[model samples]
Target: MVAEVFPLADIGLPLGARVPDFTLPDARGRLVRLAERLRTGPVVLIFCRSEGCSCCAVRLRAYLRALPELAEFGAALITISPRPPVPTLSTEDEHRRSLDVLGDVEQRVFADFGLRRELSGEPVPATFVLDRQGVVRARHVGVDHGTTMEPADALAAVEAITLG
Candidate 1:
């Protein structure tokens, strides 16, 4: 499917809000559509910092560890990074993650999701758990280099959406 990006004026994308669909390029250079993934199950959208951030790596590993369980519920985990480094870019190729480490080069998608970095321009962390209908179920937006949620906790949020 083609990319669908909802205008900021159209939807605020707050909690319990119906998320507008988006299309982004995965690490493998393939387009991933939010609407398409929602047809199968819920989605875990992680807005991460660049490769220079330490916690980004930790969070990636944690989520990767939790992927199997997330997939059991037919949920998908995706990371959106504005300007991910070379090594960080290889992560998907290295481990063959089931999810995409999408590149948001323009950060337009980032802003479309109602996200902004710190005053210093260092990317912050944010997580949104969306159900099959594309309505946001859970979310955590950080202020600085802070992380949003632990992988397991993120799974719990997704579970609440899927199982509840």
Candidate 2:
């Protein structure tokens, strides 16, 4: 657990609130539920626009590089998108395949989380940290790709929840 709490920017989901539970298919077409994953540890939900977005690629790659720190906290890295996981859409070279990119087919999951881009219907790049008990600890929501939270910020959130 993160003993020294770092200051947060702003989040849409209230702190300590329980988020909605839903199952979405992973890259392998396997159904994965948020609640089920919480059983193992905290989950860092990365709400990405698409593999095409350059900003998202940079942030995601950073997470990929920080896999060691994430594993220490027993946290899972999941990138969510409204579009289906296309085998051809290599968002950021080969390293992207290391991340679990799930598809929110109907976008109901995204809507449930209230993930929306400013002045656009697209989902904004956001990161949310949910503790093992299903309570949201911290989150960073962005209006656009350039403003999304850094991968290190997400890691900090995960550490906070896991250690707390």
Q: Pick the candidate with the highest lDDT.
A: 1
Residue 92's lDDT in candidate 2: 59
Q: Write the per-residue lDDT of candidate 2 for residues 1-164, one digit (tens) a residue.
A: 53432123432565777899988887668777887778888888888787778888787778778766776787877788778876543545335233467888677767777775334556656788889887878877776468765668778888777777
Tell me which residue pairs clash in candidate 2: 1-163, 1-164
- Model 1 residue 10 CA deviation (Å) reads 17
TM-score of each: 0.80, 0.80
Residue pairs with clashing backbones, model 1? none
Clash number for candidate 2:
2
Instruction: Write candidate 1's Cα lDDT for 1-164 as tens digits.
Output: 65444333333257888877788887557788888888888899888767567877777878888888998888888888897424343454335444777778777777777775323444446788889998888877765445457778778887887788
Q: After superposition, how far is residue 140 of candidate 2 from its true place, in Å?
A: 0.6
Give the poorly placed runs of model 2, Cα more than 4 Å off: 1-11, 87-99, 117-120
Scored by lDDT, model 2 comes in at: 0.72
Query: Runs in model 1 with CA error above 4 Å?
Result: 1-12, 84-97, 117-122
